[model samples]
Target: MDGVDLGIEPGCIFGLLGPNGAGKTTTLEMIEGLRRPDSGSITYGDHDLVRSPAVARERFGVQLQTSAFFELLRVDETIDLFASFYRHTLSTETLIERFELGEKRKAYVQNLSGGQRQRLAVAVALVNDPEVVFLDEPTAGLDPQARRNVWDSVRQLRAEGRTVVLTTHYMDEAEALCDQLAVMDHGRVLDEGQPQELIERRQPGAFIEVAAEVPITGDLRLPGLERVTHEGPKTVLMTQRLDETLGALAEWAKQEGVPLTGLATRTATLEDVFLQLTGRSLRD
Candidate 1:
């Protein structure tokens, strides 16, 4: 990671938003004391984390992207095992109930479903009852319902007054769950702010999308239109004034005998902000 600096507020869900290989995990590891940086300082309140790694180990809980537990260990046993490592910890029974794993408490790790495993991972992370939590791509592989379940758990952590820091590649997930965010790429922070603030600051306009068959071109004259680009099978028009742009687009399509199939309009999103900053899509 290069020159990445961030300030996480207490009791909020702070996110590191980036694509794969953007150094999100590396940054998390360094702060968590799993990997030491070659330079720079890390601190928690007045404590220098670099000089006092034990402070971080004792005060923070982590849920790694991939967690590996003994396949034969039961759900409750896994939580107990982790709790044994901490000087102060929450009870296994409490964690099991809070994470909604009561039914699976007796089930072996290998028998749990994807969502169950994710819940178990989170449950174990809280065994220490730390003041801060670190979740790395917590919802990366879960289905929609399961993803929402994890989202609820993250919010619950914040409600309990613990600082939650996470990393994610999903634009919607970051926008929905994060109170503050740092947009990172190539090991550097591009911007940092609330989701809507970043969107309004970096991408203040709205977008008009129509079927590619609409025959709209960059040279087309439309009031309030700023730029035009093609994405997949849709033609996107960026406009500062949504009402005037839509009116002009309809009139132009009518005059040119073009059908406006799949017409849609929406405000700028985190995906748009990322593209504008990096000159590429998140998947790129």
Candidate 2:
């Protein structure tokens, strides 16, 4: 119920992702030494994470999917408290500016917006100047701009030579930040690879999205199409041979006297890769 097999490498953002109850968090916790695995080994760089947990704790910064902080304490004060635990800490003024918390530094936790609180949480995690960072759904509830802000901070971590172990349901986020990733399900790793590699392996052609009021049945086979499926009134075709598929689709439409008013084609993505492997939606 609680173990993982992650062959992590340094200077990489490794994403371990899954739906609820998939043990993603548990796997991360074990690696971070926050919880003991029932039976497994967690080696980070040269340190045995489970055997030398004290060493692991000192080398990593942690941000849980959800966190609670002192509502009465000011933002800067909260960071100061966590800073006191470590031998070295980032300057309060620098951290405040880094996370764009300068204005809210004196504000109590309860008064901050959902996004502000998340930034503060990240600020506190980096207070220790850790070599690796574990961020679980760091931008889960943030708005678009706030999410981008968090993404920028993550890039800075990588530029600073800090490894990041992250988990997120946002497929785009994984593509944007991670050097490699693993998609999990039912407490097992379903797929793992670089974002580009996974997409290339799973699908090779541009996605042609065809929306029809009627069923897309009756032999509307497109050339180079490996698969065709329905989502609501839309039919998606995935194929490496797009020219043949498009020709076949055009003929099929003419023969059936059907109109694909919303037909669109675009490159494959991490989201498409996940759907091809899982056969289920990420939000599912």
Please give the lDDT score at residue 229 for candidate 1.
Answer: 87
User: For model 2, how does the per-residue alpha-carbon lDDT over 1-284 read when each residue is reduced to its tens digit?
Assistant: 53446677777888986677778888878877889876878786677878988877777899988868989999999999988888888988888999989899899999999999999988888998888899999989789999998899888898999888899888889988889899887888878889898888876678788987686885555568877878788898877877777888888888888876888888899888777777878877
Clashes of 1: 0
Give model 1's TM-score versus the native structure: 0.96
Give a tens-digit lDDT track for model 1, residues 1-284. 88988999999999999999999999999889898889999999999988887889888999999888999999999999889889999999999999899999999999999999999999888999989999999999999999999999999999999999999999999999999999999999999999999999999899998894645664789999999888887898999999999999899889888877778999999999999888889987
Each model's lDDT comes to 0.92, 0.84
lDDT of 1 at 41: 97
lDDT of 2 at 270: 82
**Candidate 1 off by > 4 Å:** 212-214
TM-score: which candidate is best? 1
- Measured with C-alpha atoms, the lDDT of residue 77 in candidate 2 is 96
lDDT of 1 at 144: 98
